[model samples]
Target: MTPVSAPPIATASITGLVLAGGRGQRMGGADKGLQMLHGKPLAAHVLARLAPQVGVLSISANRNGDAYAALGAPWRAGVLADTLPGFPGPLAGLLAGLRAAQTEWLLTAPCDSPWLPADLAERLTHAALSARADIVTATTTNAAGEVSLHPVFALVRTSLADDLAAFLCAGERKVRAWYARHTAAEVAFADERAFYNINSLQELAELERA
Candidate 1:
């Protein structure tokens, strides 16, 4: 598919946050973001693909802040998962990133998805702005041809940080639970492989060979 041109939204008002704070239990507890994919760590690939899509780029990592900083991004900033306790999932990363982000919008992408599309931010921003929605997430078709939401691959309004903090404080962890309270828009992509994330060594190896 042909890539879309950059949308009319100001790039400086949006920040890209790479979600690298996962526990990675499926990969034998290895840092999934740091795992090698085609001789480059997964985070590096993600950063390379996402950096140009925003004005600033930062990483939300629970560990190895130094390594993620070394991913060759000159405009990089690092935010530790400190908003909530006990690795409270991707929302914690999102909260911490929201606190650190200077932009009005925050775009999040998983560090494990090395082949993320180049027009992700542009498309999401376009969709959100058109619908006047607070959250815009990426959706892709599965093998059965059914479209599904990928919450981690989302563009959110940073103004909802306090609402998110309250939600987490109430012990709610499911992303959809919080999503239900907001007006969200989904921008679907035709290529299912674009949303495929590596959760295990076998999947990583298969992606490498593919």
Candidate 2:
């Protein structure tokens, strides 16, 4: 009898998701992603940096999906946010993206964080795979040498969608708390300023001036 060969395993493919679903209450209820940063909408900068790093991309916005669609690169036209009600925060975005993802992995970044690293997806993917972790997040050290995890900036397995959905249904919304339930890895980035996000008018001004 001839011996049977095992099937080849499929390689992982990553899709990018930009989280822009916040109400921007701190920025006076404005659409923060559409707000200006260096003469461009903040999401534009993020899209430019993140588009080249993934196979496909999507955004998560509670409103103004048309404006977000317009900011997508030429090749990425027609891409729009997966709308979810109530703006349950970044986790809702993550869950929506995961459920909608066409790939095995989902890489996420916030729209208001314009200066995200060009290597964000690559590094997070590497860390997760190397550590055999379910999730990998970008981390940065502040001037005081305090390390902080940017939970929204991460590479996550799409397979965790059910688990995340359950977590959310249980009223658990904290990103860190959810990550704690899984095997997670962290990759440190040297630039602390890279993670500086625009949460208010003053913060936007600081980034604009820089």
- Highest lDDT, which number? 1
Over the stretch 126-189, how does candidate 2's per-residue lDDT look in tens digits?
7776799989998888888888989999989999999999999888889999999999999999
What would the per-residue lDDT of candidate 1 be over residues 1-210, giving only the tens digit for each residue?
776687567888889999999889999989999999999999898989888888889999888888888886586866556566688899989899888998899999999998898889889989998999999998888789887889999999999999999999999989988888999999998877787898999999987897
Error of 2 at 184 (Å): 0.6
| Residue 124 in model 1: lDDT | 92
Worst 10 residues of 1 by lDDT: 77-86
Model 2: which residue pairs collide?
A: none
User: How many clashes in candidate 2?
Assistant: 0
- Backbone clash pairs for candidate 1 read none
